[model samples]
Target: MMASNIELEQFYSREVEFPSPLLASHIKTAEREVHTLLAGMRSILRKNIDPSIEELIVQTGSSYEGLKVKGKMELDFMIVLFHPKFIFIPVTSDYSGYCKIKFQQEQLQSEMQSSKKWTSSSPPHSFQYDFTSDGYLIPSEIYKWFQSLADKAVNQNKSKFVRKFVGNLPARTLILNISPGVDICVDLVPAICIDRDLYVVAKPLKTSPDPHLWRLSLSVFEKKILSQHQSSCHLKALKILKYLREHDTRLEETSQFASGICSYHLKTASLHQLAQRPDTPEGLLEHLHQLMDFLIECMQRRELNHFFIGNPSSLAEKAKVPSNITHGERCLNLFDDKFVKESTLNQARERLVKIKGSLPAIIQQHSGPVAYSCNIY
Candidate 1:
């Protein structure tokens, strides 16, 4: 039998909003397991390639980000290496930094085919690579080094959590099979820590994309923002947004990846809506409505501006802008460059265009109205 609106609302609260304590404990345990393996891996990297890559940043997971379902969690952890050798003193120019990055590009060729998505076509024309001391590496170098470590770990059974090879690309991947049946997989991504204090992040754009450079990934900052959000409504709204997205298949066949729309896009929309509306119980229903409405507008416009991140070059401000030709002519809009690539976005347009019209009925049916208070308050 189908659950009524009240039951559905209760289910969301009991399931997503307040996930079981046992499930929460499991997430924490899984994270601890992932961290233990990464610690060993980091030790290996330090002993082999460079001694400075000491820590891996837990980029996203239920334990930290509050963006996880009860049973499932996606661990997007990143290995950050500090520039091999460096000491910095304040400089008179726009910034202060020391150490030049000498990139190792030889090994990247092997996995270039696998990493074609992140691999860039052309190199950034000009920019001072002085922050090598700040965890940064040539895409290929990071991939090759980590690949060796992961392979060795698996072959030697170095870590108890060692999983078989899930992907060939070394940087953006390396899923660990901590358990059987792939019940728990941790994604180890190699990222250049552009600015740790700011949580400014960039990924290796190897080839098959625009250029070989550091693409912005401000998800950490977004996670931080959501952490400090005034209400848990934002999280609730995000959960529902994801549920609706997965359940609604208006354009199922058009997804570039698993689902046409992604969690990042959904989270981005939810955050934006929360900024305007309060993230309270009374505000959640309207929040979902506004969130979907915003997504529809973005699809109709054929552009979805990244709320937290922007072009990496002009990252001095609160939001970055596209660099001028002098700085590599990076894409000003992150949506255009990263999140939903042109091809994927184009494929999703048909589905997106129809979403607003279909969302109301879907919400009315799936998301019960019992929890919402429509009054202006």
Candidate 2:
């Protein structure tokens, strides 16, 4: 799961030709058309049911980690559904979005093949909420219509129709096999919005054995392993942790205490000579352990990263220990005094589980502290 700098470069090197704005605009118009159709369907269904059922809230689901099934990949659904859940395809706006998205998929597939480009991109079924201006679903009184849609599908015993009209139940995830030959899995589940409606959303559903841990863990681990080399990656880890501490203040300060210390450890470790003990498994393990401890500290402080670390200088000073300096030794006695503070406005993001009732199953405690640390020196 580690991406080398070369691999990362290759991943982004390809010419990703998105459709022109005119083409996308037409598609946007078509999307609005589809939304209109969906709204119409919900409206009709509402007329058939009693008038007392209340409003529906629609939201989409996103994948934070990769999903795997039978050792293959799949597409994650950016779910669009109504709130105040119903059985099966509980969300109301899904009925129309489903059909329209399916249609877009087929069209995109045809276009891709016609151009002779063997790309891994899925058909156009996946879309963000920005496709149409003023097009995002609102919390509206459309429950009666959704109930009627469910009833119609069930009364006829039409599973395909039910699956299509009612759609899949709200799920915590929609796994897509964008890598060819893998089947796609869509989840129909209710969504939980975190923070304001702007950024960092999570959907917690019943998941598999593997948890898609955040990419930040890998960064932390890599910085630790490369502690023997003088690399900017070490400073990168420290800055990231510092930014997280400065902007996020929703968790305990002790949670990020380790992260701050690990940043200092990485800074000191990276200053050492590379291949000081060359080609030895024992040396590698030492480096690996160093990295693990750093990552462990970050995980422990994962929740704290959501809150600001008060007395940043005090925490930094406490964490500022030298790598080779033994316990009880004064490490920074000879170094020039430097105070690292926010150079620009902080742009830190909040990382929290977006489950309705509790934190995500992929909580901090269960993440692997033993991942291979890339030598990004």
Candidate 3:
């Protein structure tokens, strides 16, 4: 049976949180450390290349990269390095679009290495230079300089607390040990600023075969949109959906559908729904039903068309991007075929049928709730 309105409401109050108070402290702590670390890096970079502050830009304001999910506190900052030598090309593929950042090696290594002390620990992961592959400085390679960067901060009369951030084996994405038992993982994405405001990044795409391809991230614009229209209900609905995916055994463990479904899907669904009908306390259930219906249909069909709904990227960027249909089939191929013998998709379908059946009793408490229709086949 599905969760009832009362049960759902109670769960929402207990589990689903918006701008979760419990996590605020952790988020603040993480942000503070991140800024400090970036400052340290910037300081050392200045000493080495001694370039003007304008060349290396740290984009981490509200419009820049940061996550809104209440469950975990994740912060993203894109470090944009602008050099006349770098070239950027935005490309479209079957799954998504990306902007390729390419640069020549002739002047980069010598020009940036004027300060020899910094290069001793991590010698700029310029393996891209070794191969014929035309490559821009990748972010993961840049992360290798944390120790030297952190040391600069220590010597320059900043807190010694930042020392912990360095000296770790740099992982793919840097995970800093903020404080005892409180740590935040950060992605110091390296991108080349394409236009004044646009950037193309090479963040590894797990869903695509081309993991190293540069993609356009409208993160700054997306954050701006959330700031403009985010309502309590929007975050609440996303949390509950995430909770269901995480806790409900049928959804989390037993369903093949769960593998394909991600927190991003749930969050984007809320954004699209809220844009159409601004959410309210009384209408929370209605919004949830809509999201559930879409999810069910998506799972049944084994194809959920990604929505560019209210994309905050510029019209020019949008103009260059292709329709999502190209990527949708590639995404659909990740899961089991819906009709195959003892198919996981079929099993997932059965689970949704049960959830749909339970909704009647689950939502009976809402006053004259709208009837929800689902294609359970």
Top candidate by lDDT? 1
In candidate 2 the C-alpha lDDT for residue 32 amounts to 40
TM-score of each: 0.65, 0.24, 0.62
Q: What TM-score would you give candidate 2 relative to the actual structure?
A: 0.24
Runs in model 2 deviating more than 4 A are 1-44, 48-181, 191-294, 300-377
lDDT (0-100) at residue 207 of candidate 1?
A: 26
TM-score of 3: 0.62
Q: How far is 193's C-alpha from truth in model 1 (Å)? A: 2.9
Candidate 1 local lDDT, 183-238, one digit each (tens): 44456665555455332223443323422334444556666666766346667667
Winner by TM-score:
1
Better of 1 and 3 by TM-score: 1
Q: lDDT by residue for model 2 over 1-377, one digit each (tens)?
A: 23233432222122111123422342333234333333444454432122221233232211111001011111222213323222121111211111101111124346545754344574322121112112222111122233344345344442211122223222222222222332233332222222122111122112222121100001122223344332333332233233223322324343333223323333333223121332334332244333334434433333212110111222222334222122222222111112111211111112311111122231222222221111111
lDDT tens digits by residue: candidate 3, 1-377: 55556766765664444344634564566557656665666666643232212335344422131234333334556666545556655445443445455665565557447635446575553333422154544433444443455456646745533323322222223454555544455445555566645566545444455434555554554455555554555555555666555434533466544554555556555555655566355556665676777666655666543334224334213344333323322332222242233365556556656655665443332232111111111
How far off is residue 231 in model 2, in Å?
Answer: 19
